[model samples]
Target chain A: MNLLKEVFMKYGYFPGCSQTGSAKEYDISLRKVIEKLGVSFDEIEDWSCCGATSAHVTNHKLSTALAMRNIMLAEQQGMENIIAPCAACYNRLIMSQFEIANHSGIRKETEELLSASFQKDVKVFNVLELFLNIGIDKIIENRKRELNDLKVACYYGCLLVRPSGLTKFDDAEQPESMEKIAEATGAKTIDWNYKVECCGAAHSIARRDIVVDLSKKILDDAKYHGANVMIVACPMCHTNLDMRQRVMKRTYPEHEDFPVLYITELIGLALGMDEKELGIDLHFIDFNYKDLVPENSGVG
Target chain B: MSVNTLKETNKLLASFVPPASFTDEEQEPLNTSVQLHRHNIADEISERTFQDVSLCYQCGKCSSGCPVRYYMDIAPNKVVRLIQLGFYEEALKSSTPWLCAGCQTCSARCPKEFDLAKFMDAVREIAIEKGIEVKEKNILKFHKAFLDQIKSHGRSYEAGLVAEYKMKTLDLLQDVDSAPGMYLKGKLAILPHNIKDRKGVKSIFKKTSGK
Candidate 1:
């Protein structure tokens, strides 16, 4: 029927650690939206954490093994393309694939360690890239209700842009696909300095003081630029901005909370899905969605 | 080494960052797009990771506790500084990456939230790809043994890991004293444990394979 529908689309989706536990909104909304696009996502069963920052540091083989294990699972499922919503997850996954592929001996070694040889053929796409592949025109055509002049800021954090070779999606310094996707859904996008800045990711757990300061800058920049919502593709960024705001307020006592929405939730809303269906209420930073919802809604 | 010598070495290492042009002919150019695209490795550091590096202020916080700094020909802080200065060649070549213990002490204490360990790992990946000979053989041997454990178990098994490691290094007899300690401390067992997610792990391995 549609390009998205006609493609017989099927892919493996690696939700990473944050999406499974913390960013429940992104995990729920992403599945629903992709389903709406007539795509089927087969999540790799028993996927382990991608080792994030710590594994790579402590041990190279371990870090690569962490990522390589996931890739191996995806390949076994015969799904060549994977949609990874987390930026860090995407970068590490893609980086591991390339590193293993270029080094034959390492690949052999990894094969021995994991009990499987990776094909290195799998492609990992972040949410934006997946949506781009699904065609913005199709999403726009599918939209029944237009976003009501909602001013949103697209936050890339760092993983999505840098290590551009791994992402191969957008500019490292300032990525606009998230913004473009927002615009395609009929919403206004804002230009902010903190677009590609760090969100003090893992530091949120071990070092709150630093994350608080970094989050303050990002939230303050978004609010200062007159953005009503900050749209992000990273679960960690969402957690820091959306969930960690209370801590930030307690620590700083000066900053106010700004709602952070995953890109999929915004797209689902703009595509006429219900708010509850997108798990909007799960966010820590409260936003009055009634004000944002139109007179008639599909997602009640 | 004494505290004073450590500090003296730290100072010498601090100047190692902003690495001078490659002194060795064996050193390969670190940042080429073809290599980056061919392998899909990020050619440049992410500004976020870089911002963490910028926080160092060249304080040597990471260098002081680094266990291998004494043995290392380069300093950990200087490695961070070098990457900060975009002298990736020297940074990648330095033995710092393989030396990381994966302890988050430096990452935890980083005044700027910089992850020196993660940066080293990234550089290590690049180095391995360039086939730049590692300064030491144990790192390479360890990598091989670790992977071998995974291949047999569909996940890592500590006993399998140690055994394969000992075999690959051809030094099974060398760590004999640790054998009694490993068994006594419940660190090693006569048999390896079966991996929990064999099928799933197998599937994961299949997808990321190059061919």
Candidate 2:
């Protein structure tokens, strides 16, 4: 707890585009959970898009330049550390930092395009990394009640850990960081196969069938492993897994309803925060907190 | 040796010889068919992305782990093979690059540490630059609409992106059921959040587009 307090006194927050619109619950829950944990963050001023999958799919330079602009903003604001809640934004910001520091061609082109000096000074951390730095014991000590009734499958998804050379946080293949944090809240974290599987990502809008097919497999794997709720770290993963269940039910009528909650939302629930306060009520899949908490747990 | 064993050995060796009709002239025509006109696409991709397609040994680990490979017209390993063989047109025309979600599962599992996801990005970029017809037109339209939203507001506007994408691809009816639910949850902000430095973002678009 002392280490957690010392390390994350204040930092920059990059709440990627989805947090404001599609995944508002993620933002809401993250804020409430982090506030309870005594972590503070200042949003980078006037930050633009991190040039997500769309930017990199069509143009390489634009992707690097757009991410660099946010890094520049953080550096100018004197933030030594920045946390990107979205896995895609964190990946792009870290990738851009790596490219600017190592690749001279990208560095020069990005500097020229943004007309700003590239200072690879600010370090980037994903939401999971932030929790890990905050220490699992600290999380356990802060929790007001144990999640005894919750069977959780911690889904890391793709961008958070893959292409290990860039993000370089956890084991890309078999990540246990989410499970470690999840177990600290006293939930039964299941050992699942589709933890790092792709949820069809941005294709949720363009190609609904593919997203439905892939997300269905993930949901089915979680259910088979006895996980009643799927926990995710990325907004994209949440959208594909949580919001696309309707399409999944239509495609496979026998598909059962499974709740998907952000890791922060799960922590908030264990911390005695109500579902409405953590924005868990906003999820597309219905989740009643009373089903999990016991009568004497003191959480209404 | 026994006489029966010697006869068996001779019979087996006899089957190893080529038929009398298979002449050296016939083999020469096979060589002509192998004389394919190869392009320098591998070098071009290497130059842009700093990834060498020649490093791929076609282990098929990338294709096996890919979640969306079933939907791709060409498998990921086959796409790399096409690039290595300098079949730029075939590689560019493949739906594999467009359908790739940049999941990086292939890149993470590759024995040779080939960045196949970045390679897919480079292929998509080069294909768009060369004005090749996009095989996944709706996917391309979605990407374009997403970028246009950023260009206008400096951040993504979900409602505007959906409206623009539907207008472009005429995919209006799909996902319409989810809209009212999203609106009810306050997930869809009707107005865009314009950044203070809109001019800076627009300049980035202009400069990156090489205007």
Candidate 3:
């Protein structure tokens, strides 16, 4: 019996803009994976966008206000912890929480504007955070299938661990939280740098050239370390690394079909969940698990 | 730093590619009028965010550790020094701030705890506000397109942003090759998603943008 089955049963969910729009596959796989883990979610109703990289880059006030709306909305729903899947959304929400709680000026200004009291008690967790706490024992116990053959490069991709103050749940320089989570899903983890490197998140839209160059370096490092698949927590990283792998061809000509999967989708596969149920076919890169996940591993 | 780390840094530095106009900046004089302009700009930066650039000492820690430094017009530490010495125009006009991926590598490794990434952001913001012709135009264009999309719809519309960006920049065929694959993978959603408190969102933007 898995201890997490009862211990981690329910959570408040906040799927950011991309979860509904561009990266629907993350939402689908995340839901299925969590359900199999016996975890239920009370999603915040009518949640707005988290004012991601765009808001913070241009207007700090607007960025905090947008995140404040969601925090207040979740508190209204009587939830203390929210499971936001997108890395950009998680970064904004968590950092905003840190700001409002510590700085009285920002807090007072935001509260008056939102017409809701700011509470420092409310906690925001990205899916990676939750998985880090979900322990390897339970993960191993729940595995119905094993990803024995696939060498995965766990890409933390800038948001999961950075800035050294807020959202620094793991080592800011060298994080192993994602590696632990990936290993629990029976995937072989590789040893390579470029874990917390930026994938040119919002720059994916305007400056594909920059993103292509940055992401190519990351992919080349992963490939050099003998990784066939790269696992990422951020949807933006997936969009840049996996979807834009073709664009990176000019830099790395010999690069092959590299699938960038959300950590939740990999967890779902380990739990013997179906591909369609997890929206596996929705990847821009052709990702067939059978090609990577070998049958009769004899280890599982 | 340890011996191994110093050796590693030297190896990385050996492969460093300086920008095209690196020697020109050294040749150009930081005249009295330019110094005054820079001083005023530094005061504005401090007044805006209360982040003191004078506290920064030239350790070169930020520069050595910066991943994108190879592609930068000036080193990250030098940008801080440029601000301290009152060279605001040089720092702003450089491709360094625009190319910053905001990965926080420099911030994480800063000995004096100065945020190099945030400083770059402030520099970029001032550049945009001043209507300075950026070294990286498409980078500026992309940021403008998203803000334009968000001001209209409460959130980013992927298709709308791409279309608007392409139309504005007239780089229609830039990444056109990737669109068909994106649509097929359900990565490109056509409909714009609006939240219920959109008016509230608009008010926030209105106040911030001062429109």
What C-alpha RMSD separates each model from the true structure?
Answer: 14.2, 9.0, 7.3
Better of 1 and 3 by lDDT: 3
Where does candidate 2 stray beyond 4 Å?
Answer: A1-7, A293-300, B1-39
Where's the lowest-lDDT run of ten residues in candidate 3 chain B?
Answer: B30-39
* Winner by DockQ: 2
Instruction: Please name the candidate that would achieve the greatest TM-score relative to the true structure.
Output: 2
lDDT of 3 by residue, A1-300 (tens): 556555455788988877876688899999887776667888898787787777776667777888888899899888877888888888888878877877788888888777789654778888877876566666788999888877999898887787778766888878888888889877899999888787777778677777888888888889889998888888888889877888787766876767788888888888988677788788777777777645675443
Q: What are the fnat scores of the candidates, in the order listed?
A: 0.06, 0.92, 0.55
TM-score of each candidate structure, all chains considered together: 0.63, 0.91, 0.87
lDDT of 2 by residue, A197-292 (tens): 999998988889999999999999999999988899999999999989998889999998899999999999888898898888888998976886
lDDT of 2 by residue, B40-149 (tens): 55666776777656678899999999999999999989988877654566788889999999999999988998899989999999888777778899999999999999
What would the C-alpha RMSD of candidate 1 be, to one decimal place? Answer: 14.2
Between prediction 1 and prediction 2, which has the larger lDDT? 2
What's the residue-level lDDT of A48 in candidate 3?
A: 78
Q: What DockQ, between 0 and 1, does each candidate earn? A: 0.06, 0.67, 0.42
Best by lDDT: 2
- Please tell me what DockQ candidate 1 reaches: 0.06
Model 3 alpha-carbon miss at residue B47, Å: 4.9
Which CAPRI level is candidate 3? acceptable
